[model samples]
Target: MGVHLDLSLDADGHHTFQWRRSDEPGALQVAPDTLQRWTAEHEQFRAATARWQQVMAEVDEHLLGDRR
Candidate 1:
């Protein structure tokens, strides 16, 4: 099974991200900065993959258009 992530705002107005196992009642608290870094990295990866996919699609179209 996969771990679940919970995100919430604390009473002090700080963001909290927690990772919990399915069988566990408690969770491990993730640092805000760590979460921010992880989010930024994920977005960067997503953008790069999207650009790559678009380029591949263009290449496929360029190559297959004459055949179609």
Candidate 2:
């Protein structure tokens, strides 16, 4: 929750973007390259998340000596 940006599609089929900072009281002022940075960060995050999921799926639950 430190700092984050979001992008979505509105009902009118247009792109909506926003950024927030938990340390600040209001919306953040975006820089010119904000979208470019978000795109790169999001791609890296997605790749890392997918790799994590794949690793978890390959793990043997019995190794932890726990059952759910």
Candidate 3:
């Protein structure tokens, strides 16, 4: 009766998401809206991470200029 969602890497090493119910035999494709939401969330996460990395780089430059 319960459902499970999992994230895994495919053969090409890309991230994939799958969901299944206890009574189901195989993984089910994610719904279109759910997939779209996940993609949007992932993009937001990536953008946030990139901004963080840039901030860290600037800090490093300010602290360790011409040394690193």
User: Who wins the TM-score comparison?
Assistant: 1
Each model's lDDT: 0.69, 0.66, 0.70
- Model 2: per-residue Cα lDDT over 4-39, one tens digit each: 657797675766565656556554555647656876
Using TM-score, rank the candidates from best to worst: 1, 3, 2
Model 1: colliding residue pairs: none
RMSD to the native, candidate 3?
A: 7.3
Error of 3 at 35 (Å): 0.3
Cα miss at 17, model 2 (Å)? 8.6
Q: How would you order the candidates by lDDT, starting with the best?
A: 3, 1, 2
Query: What is the TM-score (0 to 1) of candidate 3?
Result: 0.56
lDDT digits (tens) for residues 10-67 of candidate 1: 6757665555445454544556676677778767866996799899999999989979
How many pairs collide in each candidate, listed in order? 0, 0, 0
**TM-scores, each model vs. reference:** 0.59, 0.44, 0.56
Off by over 4 Å in 1: 1-3, 6-25
lDDT of 2 at 45: 69
Candidate 3 lDDT by residue in tens digits, 1-68 = 34467889867586866555544565455566776677688788769967998999999888897676
Task: Write down the lDDT that model 2 would get.
Answer: 0.66
- Sliding window of 10 residues with minimal summed lDDT for model 3: 18-27
